[model samples]
Target: MSSIRGARVAALSAVVVAAFALSACSGGATDDPPASAEQTLRLSAQAPPSSWAIGNAPGGDATMYLSVYDTLLRTTPDAEITEGLAEEWEYNDDLTELTLHLREGQEFTDGEPVDADAVVASLNVSREGPSTATNLTAVSDVTATDESTVVLTLSQPDAALLPNLADVAGAIGAPDVLTAESSTLEPVGSGPYILDSSSVAGSNYVLKKNPDNWDADSFPFETVQFQIIADPTAITNAMQAGQLDWIALNTPDQLAQFPEPKYTSGSNNANGLGVLWLADREGTIVPALKDVRVRQAINLAIDRESIAEKLQVGSLHPTEQVVNPNGGAWSDELNETYSYNLEEAKALMAEAGYADGFAVTMPSTFLSTPYEPTFSQQLGDIGIQVTWETVPFQDFLTKVFSQNYGMYFMFNAFRSADSVDVRGATTAIFNPFNSTSPEYEALIAEANSSESADAFAPVNEYFVKEAWFAPIFYTAGPWVASDKVTYTPAKTFYPSLKPWAPAN
Candidate 1:
């Protein structure tokens, strides 16, 4: 993984230097403009927008949501938070109240003022919306104290609140459009671009640059078109044929097709925490998983390093903890605690009175994983019968949240304004439905109350000790783009176009 990443960095640096030289020698010629000077950007996207409303859109489709609406706070590709719609924000000493000062002189696409009242309405809508409601669980009330100031009062001291607001929850909408039923179809926002009415739903979307937008100069492109292409092969074909300017490659095989010079590629540490959900820990649905020994055995059954090497295509870092490796809460000791030991795993299963093994069902979204067969084989060796079920990505979430399966595979990379916010990641996975341990809850409360990384270490340790989750890896992937454009990937699961610029 290190070698692959090093080569990508070296190649990207060369491409950037060449781009700068070409720009310097151009002499501001408008007649013989560079290929990138064709400002209309056509890109490929994996997830199509379900609705025009930012709050209703799936959280994973950030590329679409961010193109239509701007958040109160903007997160850079390097994971640094900067001002967006809001000029500044501060939390009270007790950490229960948060105040946001909106940037004056800004207006929504509908010519409405981007004031505190608009922000308050937008946030309240988000709080009731499906996409952001779970993240804003700690929020109690939102109020507009003044013309340009909005205050959010939380029921508890939530360390993840700011980060949650930085996501879809903080996207401010036009007051008039906020109550309209067609807001999901025809949206009004204060973002750099406005959704064009000519856009064809599901197939493609066109966004025209908003002339009144404050950050219009930074966007550069006059028009941006997003083409929905879920198939990897189709996306690669579109890029090769010059129909698409940018796309993300989930595997190294897809990335290898786009060579350097003609294409510039870069990678970011995936904010993702790949985990296995053993939902029936109490044996209400699956009797075998009730024993602690059985759960511990399940943890040691699979070889995560091998999975990363083969399935991840040198793009992931094998991990045992939920916190990202870049974050301060990550612990090397916890990562090494559950080393792969098939013999021990089998022994533990036998000790738990499962010598004859029990039948269990595992649900998956993808057709297969690099180590899926091996994972099942290992369990079979310990007398556990395995059954596999496949479902769509949307249905996958519904099943997990409804607790409809015994075990399932999932990944989460919840990002907030604070780059080191471990609480955001932990809370995203171990919510009320999934986690019921009182000791773990107490540790989480203590960690969330403190601003120090050392305080959160114990919570991560507790997650590992209790075998709450079997974390597989820290995933990362390449963002492949034509040399006509220079692109930087965001440090989040969902891709955003904010970091892309013309190569010239």
Candidate 2:
């Protein structure tokens, strides 16, 4: 099975290379300038869609969804919520109900009107979809109250609802296309670009400008092509050869390869928590990890600053909390508590009755994280033995989401606009590690009910004090683009086309 998957991936890469070559010569007239002079932009990305269905793809595939469909609301890199399909929205005084007013005279590419009914239909479909189920867990009902008004009623007050709506979960598809069985292959949306079916999935994708789109003027490119080149070396080679206009720099080393005069580069802090998972707090996997002191000891043992400076080479910011620095829940007091002290860690380990230390197993992935070696070494110094279990990327994701690991390290980007968004991020990632403690449950409930950052601060402080998960850092990477196009990288983990424009 592994070999078969590898063969498919290799074939896909070859197809992308071929399609990219073909795109340069196919579209223009003989008198037209060279392919590089055309308004079309070419991008090389790591993941292409396995399934184009909105609900079937992972939440991280927001860029792909946004390319074809527009959400009810849009979130900026700074986490601000702005209008998308819906022109305006407001929550009722009690906050259990949200009312949205649709933009006037909008239509999907299929020529169906985008109104209250359309919004309700899309929301209903998303609520039942696997990728979006968690985001809409609180939503009880969606109703089209009138031609232009749609009301969403929640079982309880949830601060993250609006922000989640700004993500891929809230993407609105055309009713006609959505109801059809071929919806996955032929998506119809009201966004600035329409997906061209001529391109193959998982290899290459072509998006033609939607001239009839309401926000047509907002999009500067006439065409956008995405080539799924999984190999990092191939992506760099393609960029240098001028076959690709934009590429994301996964490492700081790639920064030097794209120099000035010919290319432009930009970066922003990624919107997620880089977490050290000390899962199995209930003693399901490692008996020693059940104690809160043990978790705190592990947190104090690792030198996060050194790892960021040496391994990451300043590409990431060492973070003690899961919330973004600008978020309302971020606390200077809490961040100060995470100073690395070996003696303190040793003392905590003794207090937790593990002075001799205990052994724990962790799964290893193909992608090497800076935390792995440092975590193992520091924990070993404090008498903890770590046994590594090597696994593929798919198996790793399955285990992490299934809560089958004792210890693991990974990062998650939370699309946060405020303190309420901080709480939302907490719920989305940390809920799986939750225990049956009444105090913890009460804190979570209060955080969920909060409407502002001030109300959510205590919950954020509580998680930090408990040392639930050790946050390593906030990551940011470079987006290298050619001099012909002007682009501003979104403060997100993924690249987006919405912020791109022609250079002046």
Top candidate when judged by lDDT against the true structure: 2
In order, what is each prediction's RMSD in angstroms?
A: 7.5, 7.1
List runs of model 1 lying over 4 Å from the truth. Answer: 1-38, 253-256, 367-371, 392-394, 414-432, 453-455, 490-495
Each prediction's Cα lDDT score? 0.64, 0.65
lDDT of 1 at 199: 86
User: What are the per-residue Cα lDDT tens digits for candidate 1 across 258-367?
Assistant: 88888887665544446676656677778877787888888898688887786656566788887655556678878887799989988988999987889987775453
Worst 10 residues of 2 by lDDT: 20-29
lDDT of 1 at 457: 77
Backbone clashes in model 1, listed as residue pairs: 163-416, 357-383
User: Which lDDT tens digits does candidate 2 get at residues 194-221?
Assistant: 9986778778889888888776766677
lDDT of 2 at 119: 84
